[model samples]
Target: MVINLSPVYIENSLLFANTLVMLAVGLTLTYLTTKVPNFAHGSLAMVGAYALFTIAAIMFGNQLSQLQLAQPLGLGFAAAFLAGAFAGLLEYLLVLRPLQKRGSTPLGLMIATLGVDLILLGVLNIFADILRGMNPVTGTTRDWRLKAYVIQKVAGLSLGVWISFGIMIGSLVALYLLLTRTRFGIAMRASIENPALAQVLGVNVDLVNMVSWILAGGFAGLAGGMMAFVQRINPATGSIEVVAVFAASIVGGLHSLLGAVVGGYVVGLSETLLTKILSDITGVNLVTYKRAVPLIFIIVTLLVAPEGIMGINWRRLFSRIRSRK
Candidate 1:
């Protein structure tokens, strides 16, 4: 069926997909390093968003023309990355590391991540209050969005879309080079593959894990900074959006970084498009329920292929299907 969608919606979907790619990759990397799903990962993204907001507010007073705001927002991306990296590192060093030393079970570590998420959420709320007191903007503490300020379009799409797409591609290429060409990357691979053996081989597994968290957090922050342009940013925005991130990571194959990339686009586009399509057919507004798409994907993936897309033996399955035909 031909489904005509608005260009705006399409652009938003692509932008959201790109952001998910970064978040999913980060989530997968951290999971690989710690063997635990970080419940606090989304909060890290929010930390980045707030960082961007802080920089923008300070430099431009949270209200400015597109031209005037552009520079600070551009610089805010870097600030966001550092802020997120710092937060992730602190989580690992201050919370996870101590718990690990005490022989915390994987479940315990997972719960600890949830605790960390709550702590981060509280901190974010407090930060929002501070921003409101300082700026006194209408939406400073809630429902912050910069969509109006992003007036420039590239190839008929928002600049944020191109920026997010570029960052995702660049991050993947950098990760590829880091894993394959660099000595440290090789060591990191070894550590992820087999920490005990890597440790015996004189690779500092702890350092590798620490670096992984930093990279993950930085990617998340970068994505969050981009998100401020396209979506509303509140303190709880990350927590609400993490459902899509987890769905992408799971659908992509939690154990495979490449899978995370694939899953991000798949889930992101499907969530946006499918919701639109269904809404049109049913004559009901479904944007509020768009998140249900990712939840369904998670449930279906777990039930149909617990190992995810990357875990399937495609060649073997195809051969079997051919034989049956």
Candidate 2:
């Protein structure tokens, strides 16, 4: 029997996939440049989500639920991006840079990011509480902590859906242009390929690392802000979702940004679709196991090809196909 998919499910899956893409790309960039898998990347997104809330609070008084449909969404987006970038830069300068200067290994750096993640998570929790209190003492039907501004729709889909997908496309296109068409992009590529050699060739490796962190953080924050509108934003959910981000990065080939983007959508769709299909078939609520989907992806990818999607030798496959023909 064919089971019809709901448009809501399709929209949610696509929206989540696009958000995951932004996150995975940022993580891949940081890894390629710094050789450190930033565990705190998700927290940056959480921070961005809070930043968006803060912007809304400022614009529409302490309670974000009070925000009207006429409020400018652009300001919230800009605030989230800048807030995430700043947080990333601060972490690099304060924590990661100091560790690197002390001759820390990749493992050490990764641990340092975990520590940073914990610190950021704590801060986010406190900040969330503050936002929760922004609502007046008088009882109101609205909830600031779970405030969702989702009126303005385009062709029946929420504006956030369009903006998130647009950001996903725009980020990838801009990244391609940056890597292929700009001097800094070339320098970044060189640094990623061989930092020692690039440094010897006059490429400022330090500057490139800083820029990568900023960009990664900005993207993460953007994803977080978009996700807040897509779903509820809470501090507890921040680190919980990092598994999916890491899974996407791994399935995409941690070293390949292209792989990360592809893996993100693959994992994102699996997370939603698998649970949905299983639920329909078994007539049981299987959505609770949605988190396991990414882990399953991670295990399968590792077992089949640890190098991930981009790791496959396409040229070799093409040559073999031609020989068979």
Candidate 3:
């Protein structure tokens, strides 16, 4: 059966928005911990998606079971969430911490993260090959069925968009609570500011950093799982996704959660709209370039403002500055 790429792109645009949430969380964590950009964050997402694949295979083969979905979706989300922290732990213990101890500049730490990213990429490819070669259930068929869950077709699109908006609002509330109402959030901010000061003041700086990573990674994992459910995950998918996420992050402005959210919807709408426009305009098919729009926009945005559509005045930042002034 031949699948039209336009609808695939449309669906994938939604999937990308869902997945970008994970990347935004990651980008936010990196901004907090390392003060240097992380290019390898995409690799972690790849890992999360693969982890879902592995779990899905182990739990369900050649059969699409709701139970199977929950098993991986639930457990895998926990694991993915931890993956973020583990990444943070590695960044702190192996890369940033050591480099900072040696007086290595932030640029060095950033480069080191890129190195970690590449190393993980190679390792993941090896895993991919191994998984590909060995079919655990040697002759088992793969299940590619989409469960028919929704009943109303008339309002599905509007419903989905509303759900997306609700998620955004909920995330904002949760983030605010964490940042302002929780001790751990306070510690995270403090450690981001001055680890030595935080440590001297008895804030377990190392532990807080670890927690942040775990939280960020796990969130990324869950996001990836949600995406895999909505789309499909292969062993070796990369910039195919990172590009869209980069766009959303840029549009949302790199460090702000709200920016990421707004950026996601913008990219989602733009993806659908662009494909429609291109399909009509040049008569050249845009299925190939639909996903690429986000990346292209990211580059364009960076070249222009680079500060992101939301700017740096995060809600938290605004509240803090107002208090100070």
Candidate 4:
């Protein structure tokens, strides 16, 4: 069968996948370290997107070209990253940390994250309203408030594309190195695996948790900022994709970083490709129901292999095959 795919669809799918990778990594990392499914993770990304918007519109007037070395964008990126990290740190320090001290259950911590998510979303809406009142140099207040923003192009592709790809690649490399080559990484792994044991070994479990939240928050922020340029940026932008991000993490094995990365690509492609193929074949517009893709993945994964793709023991399977042979 000849399955002709449009280049635009493919490019968009990759872009979406890359974005999911960023968010999924953060979700998985947070879950690994805290053992809580942080529903507020996506809100942290949304905060980062707004940080980019604030820098580009209010701080720099959206005329970054006049700056040398594109420092404005650089500053904006830093601001977004920092904002995301701060949001995460704040959530942990203010809510999760206190709750942990009081011996809160994992389910309670997870519910707290939901509360944080609602609060953050409300704050974002208020911030957007404030932006709606400000008159920026670029366009109308509404335009500057929460509309889409695009970066300059290089080699005919928007700079946002390169930025997103760079963040994903750089994050992967940095995380791998941090986990495998650094003392902190070792501490983090020990803490995640056994907090009591790690603390006994002088690993500083609390410190590890703080650092992980910071890193996860930073990644989400960077992704959100890059995504704001590629798509529309509003208060709901981050919350809108939480399902896909969660699916990526869960399908990859919530405890496995590599699995999360692979799952992000899988869900990303399925969300786009499946919708297109099914729409074309069934003569029905399935694009509107694309959001259900992740839900389906979640259900299937729960039924078939609750541990997810990475949870499977490949070595044992290979050993059994060899023994039979």
* Candidate No. with top lDDT: 1
TM-score of each predicted structure versus truth: 0.94, 0.89, 0.74, 0.88
- Total clashes in model 3, counting residue pairs 3 or more apart in sequence or in different chains: 7
> Which is better, 1 or 3, measured by TM-score?
1
Score candidate 2 by lDDT: 0.83
Q: In model 2, how large is the Cα lDDT of residue 7?
A: 76
Clashing pairs in 4: none
**What is the overall TM-score of model 2 with all chains considered together?**
0.89
Clashes of each: 0, 1, 7, 0
Please give, for residues 238-304, the per-residue lDDT of candidate 1 as tens digits.
8888899999999998999999999999999888877888778777888778879999999999999
- Model 4 residue runs over 4 Å out of place are 1-4, 59-69, 135-153, 313-325
Q: After superposition, how far is residue 33 of candidate 1 from its true place, in Å?
A: 0.9
lDDT of 2 by residue, 1-325 (tens): 2455787677778888888999999999999998999999999988777787777656654344533534646787788899999999998999999999999999999999999999998898778676665642222212233224553567898666777888789878988999999999999999999999999999999999999999999999888877765566677566878899999999999999999999999999989977888788887877888989999999999998899989888899899999999
Query: Could you arrange the candidates by lDDT from highest to lowest?
Result: 1, 2, 4, 3
In Å, residue 185's CA in model 4 sits off its true spot by: 1.1
* The candidate that achieves the highest TM-score relative to the unseen native structure: 1
State each model's C-alpha RMSD to the native: 1.9, 3.5, 7.0, 3.4
Alpha carbon lDDT of each predicted model: 0.86, 0.83, 0.61, 0.82
List model 4 lDDT by residue over 285-318, tens digit each. Answer: 8888999999999999988878988998889989
Sort the predicted structures by TM-score, highest score first. 1, 2, 4, 3
lDDT for 283 (candidate 4) = 75
